[model samples]
Target chain A: MSDAKLLRDELRKKYLEFGLEAMSDEEVVRLVLSLSCNEFDSFTEKLIEGFGSLKSIEDADPQALVRYSDIGERSAVLFRMVSEISRCLAVKNVKKGVYLRTTADAKSFFAPLFTDHREERLAVVCLSSRLKAVAPASVIAEGAAASVRASCRRITALALDLKADGVIIAHSHPSGKAVPSSGDCASTELLASALSRFGIALIDHIIVAADDCVSLRETDIPLSFRDRECFGYKITKLL
Target chain B: MGKGSIHSGHRDRMRSRFLTLGSGGFSEHEILELLLFYSIPRANTNETAHALIERFGSLENVLAAAPEELMTIKGIKSESAFVIRLMHDLCKRYSATSDVSADLSDDEKLEGFLTEYFSENHGNVCLLLDMTPRGELRSTKCLPTSSLLSGELGSREIAELVVRNGFVRVVIGQCIDGDKCIPDASCYSLTRLFAETLAPLGTELHDHIICCSGKCFSMRKNGSFSFGSGGNHE
Candidate 1:
């Protein structure tokens, strides 16, 4: 057998013996790839070279994987499956509990939304009467490289369908600071207003970036529940 | 200030009441005030709550308002605002999963539900299930660590376990391998003994399943064990 096949067999044995955490991300990718496939080693190296990290690789599209590399269609499909499985496993921890009671709970529940990323992704989690997660739906996934703009209308529609009592809107900033930009503040207000019309509370907006999370509600900023009137902050430029 | 002291006094009373009565005791403003304490630490949140309610026209509106509007109020910072938001999100998450009860008559659904507790490292589990008359799962417990992966557990130990739990209609699931759904011939030998033990107690062993990877095999479904009686044990 070729080197990749030999390595894959070894990793499989270790995975069965130890656990999923036994192998690193690239090791996982290397093991999943084919020994018989043509022009894959240099392709992996080049893909990593271009993306700079394993998370970026996982976040990229299979179309991008195929377009950027010299690998076959089947290999790209397999790579996508691996990436999807990794995400599923990451989110599985939060699925055990139906309710979230604290910002820490919200942070833990939404961690999967932030992990393995190269660009921003915005999502809204809808909650029922007891503060339990009803559905966590994606609001905007196909944003620009550095930012994502979530639509208030779409989030309101989803919360209405779930008959949600509350909503948590969140986003990831890839490898940057977790602080909300001025635009983030502006958009959140719009979304919050929209959600309020349906009597669903816009609970909090969380930004996850670089292993840290910033809760806009928990920050020392002027934005808080006690003051809900728009104080003439010239945010039109930012929005 | 006198106003600060009054607000602090009210916040303390609200918090104490909340501990005793749970969230059922608080109004929307009271709930928002309580949640804000986590983020704001030592602030008098009375005026804070009032300001928000006035601007947003209700407790939900205040909690849901944009951070910019929240910022316009004094003492309402990011930290305090986050807690309000958190309370809202927590409500949403709790509602999503609490609506469904875990009872079902379908075998496939039971199997799917049971699979949640199994993973590669944890496949050593053996579940003792108390089943309803309609084959719905009433309760399930893993036979303790002493009888875990060693496979030293016989039907006698399982019989005692079922007796202790007072379970009548039973189903057993043992994972032989982490990823393989196949059962050994030993499953039949053990299940036969289980049926034999339960027959005298007026209870029944309905099924014995071998769970592995993501699939399972049921002895009752395959007709591997005879449902006949044996009741000579003390």
Candidate 2:
């Protein structure tokens, strides 16, 4: 076999045995590029030099990737596909029937739904009396880049429809701060009161911004419920 | 009080408790007794439930018991056995539906899922995870395996399945009966054979996980095998 073929074979062997973590950024890029390009060694080197790192290469748009002399549409598409797959795999959904009792649980469950959203969005997690998620988190509202409104009437109606004993409200802020706005705090109190009149508890309100999330109940916000003693059976903490 | 009135009063209270407090309010025997109310009818199942727990050691084992094994106990007829089996199948169905959209690309998440997937079964089985190009799980298939080298699941058959399903990426999991998570030489050979067979078809074998007795060993993570173009072993 030729020298290029020998090197490619060696890399494939290493990947199959030791997996992706064992490979360097250049080696991984080379292996992926080799699948599409004939003279992949030079193509891999050129792309790496332009992008600077494996993460940057994965994040690079197809248009930017195709600017390289050796990288064609097929290679560009492959690179983008790999990047998209990695992202999808990374942000897993909170499965149904999982308990959402703590702020940490609420964060993990809500964070994935808000990933990569430029526009603000609001979601409600309907919980059973036992604090287990009764259904998948529902995206109730979507608005412009900076602000989204939560409809108290609509949220109350949804809780009743699902027969949920409690609900956790979450919304995304594209501005990259997990702090709740004054409007956020005001609306959460109103939402809590509306839910409480019907015997439903507004367990918590979470604000997600970029990678960070903050639970409003954990904050100094003075949001109070009419019947905090109702769903006091299974909820141990963060009630 | 007579037996009939006493049984009726107890049943009414149990039903009321379940409705008000859910499964968390009930003990193991109480849960089983509540379940048996539908199948057995009228008679107090509290004793039967206790007998089942004593025989099988736990509610999980009692539910997992074979129909014949369940019928070995007094008052557990075919109807009771059928209900018990149905409950077990229902739990499996619920778990499967809940986990339908699970992303199995992360090693730790994948291991946890595989371990739970194989928890009930003591037999050797091979699980195939058909994933989309975007790494989302499309479907999962579990096939019983006597051995890896057995003709039950050859590399050609796996390749055909991948091609038929149009799966761009896949994960193969082998669940052994015992607690040894280590994969022998046959496992390595099978991985290479699978990788080679699928590579030509543009389908990538993402990883081969070995799950044994609640523990999981990831071949891709540990790494020592090769799927070279030629027969050049490293």
Best by lDDT: 2
**Per-residue lDDT of candidate 1, residues B1-234 (tens digit):** 676687667666765454333332345566556656545545666678777877787655664576677878777886566445433432332223221224545678767655644432242444556654444344444442223223445556556555544555667766565455776665665666667678877676767788777787877777777564332211
Position A191, candidate 2: lDDT:
83
lDDT of 2 by residue, A18-105 (tens): 7566777688778767655678899887766555445445434343355433476555544444333333323323457898867778
List iRMS for all predictions.
21.9, 22.4
Candidate 2 has a DockQ of: 0.01
Clashes of 2: 1
lDDT of 2 by residue, B71-147 (tens): 99999998788656645643433343234446665788888877876674334556667653334454454443433
Off by over 4 Å in 2: A1-61, A69-82, A85-92, A143-150, A210-212, A226-239, B1-234
Each prediction's DockQ against the real complex: 0.01, 0.01
TM-score of chain A of each: 0.58, 0.60
Score residue A92 of candidate 2 by CA lDDT. Answer: 24
